[model samples]
Each structure stands twice: as structure tokens, then as C-alpha cells.
Target: MTYTIRQAVAADLPLLADIERAAGALFADANIGEVDVDDVAELRLIESVARAGGVFVAVKDDAPVGFILAAPLDIHIHIYELSVHPAHGRQGLGRRLVDAVCDDASARGFKAVTLSTFRDVPWNAPFYASCGFRILDPAEWTPAFYLAHYHEADMGLPLERRCFMRKELK
Candidate 1:
């Protein structure tokens, strides 16, 4: 099926929230218990998608199947979130969304893009590695990156073991 990727509008908030909830539940089921399904972060995500960022939704035959959210962070673009509906997994939609975000970062003159995901999850770290993101070594990581990881840790997330990945856009 052909999916069209387009910028998200305010009207897309409801569906986006639904997608986030479904994706979060899938993660929880995969043993990622650190995530709180009822957390307000999902609401904040919708707000982020509506401002200072770009959200690309993959719509197939008029139905939203997946979406990716990208926002500038210092000199790089951070892929805040990307999720494909559970039913749509392994269908290339995720990669397509990432590719679109990278293209946008390149066009905006960003030097790189960064994201973090569970290190041992098949649907996380390994998937990103295949897309050219290399796991950053803690010793070589920037102070900002370290702080970000620490913040995640404070949020009850197991970020100490999560892999921070970065891909140069240039």
C-alpha cells in the first residue's frame, strides 16, 4: 500500500494521541514497564507536534498508520518520537518516516540527528542501527547528552541501559 507523508495539523491531535497511546501500550506489553500509560507526556507530545517541530503522518487509503515527530535541539534535530500502529509493524513505514525526518533535518542545515531507545529491544536499538545511527559511547558523549540521559533516569526510565544513537546529517 502507498502511504502519503505530510505535516501534521492541529486537527490531527486526536488521532495522534490515540496512536501514542497504542504505541505506548505495545511497549508496556513488551516489558518496557517504565513507561506510564496515563502520563501527561503524551499530551505534551501532541502540543509539541503542533509547534516548533514537524510531524509527518503516514496515511494509507485515508487512515493514519504511523507518524514521526522531529524537533530542533541545539545544533541537531531530535527525533522525539516515532511509532507505527502495531498492525502496521515491519511494513517499512517506520523507515519511511525516519527518512522523511532526516531529509527535513538536512534541508534545515542541521549537522546531525539524535534519538534514544531501549538497547535490547528488537523494535528499538537494532532497528535504528540499521538506519545508520551509531550507539554513542558515554565517554565520548557530550555534557548535554549525559544530562539528557540523567534526566531520563530521574523520570524512572531505565535510561542507564538505553542506547543513545546519533547520525550525522551532513
Candidate 2:
């Protein structure tokens, strides 16, 4: 199936939560960490991101099957979330959504794209690496990265299995 990537509109916001839940369910099967089905982007947050022009969706038959959420950080685009329904998984939709964010950031003259993900999850760090992101060494971490780790820790994520990565746009 061919999926098209585009900026998300207000009407598309509600569907994104469903996509997030479905996508996150995949983690439950991974048997790692707590998988909270309700841990999804709230409508308010999605609306805010949409308004900021930072949300993009992968649409199939005019419905969102996947989406990527990002925003400008101090010097790069920070991808807060990326999700593709498990039913639609392994189709490169995730990669395409990631590429869209990277392309958008590059066009806006951002230095790079950054994100945090599970280091041991094949679809997390390894997938991002395949997309040209490199795991940032501890010495390469910035203040923002430290804060990100703090936030992740506060959320009960396994920090030891988490790592920050960056994909330079230039």
C-alpha cells in the first residue's frame, strides 16, 4: 500500500491518538518496560503541535496510519514521537515519516534532528541508526540531553536502555 506523508490538519488530530495507542501496543509484546496504552499524546498536545506545524501524518486511503511529532529545540528538531500502526509495520512508513521530519528540519536550516529511544529495542536505536542517526556519546551530550534523560527517568522509562541520538542534516 502506498502511504503519503503530509502536514497534519486539525481534523486529523483525533485519529492520531488511536494510531499512537495501536503503535504503542507493539511495545507490550516486546516485554520491556511498562506499556501504558493510555500513554498517548493528548488532544490538546496534538492540537498544539499541529498549530506549530510540527505534526506530520502518513496517510493511507486518506486516513492516518502513522504520524511523527516534532518541534524545534535549541538548535535542532526534536522528534517527540513517531508511530506507525503495527498492522502497517515493516512497510518503511516509520522511516518515511522520520525522513519527512529530517527533510523539513534541513529545509528550515536546522543543524540536525534529535531524539531519545530504547537502546536495546531493534526498532528504536537501531532503526534510527539506519536512518543516519548516531548514538550520542556521553561526552557529546548537551544540557538539553541531560534534561531529556531526567524527564525519561521521571516517566519510569529504563534509562540504562535509553540513549540519545542525532542525525546531522548538513
Candidate 3:
């Protein structure tokens, strides 16, 4: 049950992508239309985050079971991706990853953490709600956050099913 949270390294990019694939499978039965397991995180992006210390991995038994990637977008820390292998689900790895990102954001003087997820997915929006993220009103959205809705829609993810959420850092 013990896991270590540490900055991701060069060797973890592929493993993180693998974990992303396994975690994305959980959406298969959510009836969210489709599950694109092949759309895992790209190695270059992962490597960039890893090099910049914006990525963290939950390691158990010397293997990465989960990872979270964050980036500074405008005035906030945007959680670009968070994925935990299905086998590690419900073990709090995801929350821990979010906390890790939040800590880094605080260190960087960011005011909030932001992310987007499917509102109807049991483990997506609801889980984030439990973590103190509330749905962001359009008026509250930064230009990038506002445009992300259309970007997602253009990518085939219905706008109505997805939403941006924010958690203020205090």
C-alpha cells in the first residue's frame, strides 16, 4: 500500500503512457461514446514535462502506477493529464498526484489548479468535485480555458459532456 511520489524521469515517459492506456480503459463502459486507448500521452510531451519537473509519478515496487502532468497556463497551473493504472484505482493515487501538482503550483505562486473532464463520467468530474474543484462559469474562464471548450468540441468530444473546473489554492 506504500507508494512514493517523485518527479518523473527520462525512463518513465513510456511507462506513464502505458498507465494512461490502462486508465483510459475505464472509460470504455461509461458510455461516453468511445474509448481511445491509442490516444495516450505522447513521449515528447511527457519528456518535456519530466525534464521541467512538471510531472510526478506514483511508484510502487519500482514501477510507475500513476502520473500527473501540469503546466503553467496564463495565471494558473493547468493539470494537463492525470492517469493511474486501473489496478491502482481507489487507492488514492490520483488524489495524491493532484496534491503533488497543487504543491508545485503553490511553490510557483499560482493561484489555482485547473482541469477539464467529462462531467458525466463517474471517476472524472465527480472525483474532482470531491477534491474541491467546482465547475468554472464561462465568465470565469480565461481566454484559453474558454477556447478549450471549442477545441475539445472540434476534436469530437461533446462540449456539453465536458467542463472546466478550478480549485483555488489557499
Candidate 4:
């Protein structure tokens, strides 16, 4: 199936939330952490991201099947989230979204793209590694990373299983 990758729009926010819910459901089968089916980007947040040109979506047959939310942080493009409906999983949607973001970031002078994911999840850190991302050592973390870690800890996420990754765009 062919999918089109484009900047997300205000009207696409609701569909993005649906896609996120479907994607998050996959983690429930993983049996790790609390899988909140409602754990999704809020409409206003998605609107703001769309307005800032920081959100991208994958559309299949005119329906959104995935989305990637990103922001500029620590002089790099930080992917806040990337979720695709499970029905569309393993079809390279994630990589396509990441590549589009990375290309945009590189053209905008960002040195790298960074994100955090489960350390052992086959489709998390390992999948990112296959896409040219490498695990970032704790000693090499930026100040923003420090704060992000603190926030994640406070949220009661599995910090021990979290792995920060970076893909240098140069």
C-alpha cells in the first residue's frame, strides 16, 4: 500500500489521536507499563504542533494512518512521538516519517535527531538503531535530556528501560 507523507493539518488532529490510540494499543500486548488507550496527543497540542509545522502525517487513501510529532530541542530535532496504526505496522511508515523529519532538520541546520524509547523493545531502540540512531551515553546527555529524564521519572515511566537515541544528520 502506498502512503503519502505530508505536514499535518488542523483538521487532521482527531485522526492523529485515533492513529495514536491504535498504535499505543500495540504496547499493551507487550505487557509493560500502563497502556492508557487514551494516552494520545491532545487536540490543542496537535493543533499547535501542526501550526508550527512540527507535525507530519502518513495518509493512506486519504485517511491518516500515522503521525510523528517533533520539536526543536538542544539544537536538534527531538521526536516527541511517532505512532502508526497497528494495521499499518511493518510497512516502513515510521522510518519514512523519521527520514522526512531528519531531512527537514538537516536542511534547517540541526545536527541530529534525538528520541527516547524502550531499551529492549524490538521495535523501539533496536528499530531506531537500524535506522542509523545510536544509543546516547548518559555522560553525553545535554541539559534538556537531564530535564526530560527527571520529568519521565516523575511520571513513573520505566526509566531503567528508557534509552536515549540520536542520529547525526551530517
Runs with alpha carbons beyond 4 Å of true place in candidate 2: none
lDDT of 4 by residue, 1-170 (tens): 99999888767788887888888888887757787889677888877766657899889988889989988878888998999999998899999999989988898888999998888888899989999999999998999999999988987788999978999998
Instruction: Report how far residue 150 has shifted in candidate 1, in Å.
Output: 2.2
Question: Which ranges in model 3 have alpha carbons more than 4 Å from their true place?
Answer: none
Better of 2 and 4 by lDDT: 2
Clash pairs, candidate 2, are none
TM-score of 2: 0.96
- Prediction 1 global C-alpha lDDT: 0.79
Candidate 2 lDDT, 1-170, residue by residue in tens = 88899999888999988899988888987767688988898899888877777899999999999999999776889999999998899999999999999988988889999999998888999999999999999898889889889998899988888999999997
Candidate 4 Cα misplacement greater than 4 A, ranges: none
Residue 102 lDDT, candidate 2, scale 0-100: 92
Native-referenced Cα lDDT, model 4: 0.88
TM-score of each: 0.88, 0.96, 0.95, 0.95
Tens-digit per-residue lDDT, 145-170, candidate 1: 77778888878777655878899886
Tell me the TM-score of model 1.
0.88
Indicate whether candidate 2 or candidate 4 has the larger TM-score. 2
lDDT for each of the candidates? 0.79, 0.90, 0.87, 0.88
Best by lDDT: 2
Count of clashing pairs, candidate 2: 0
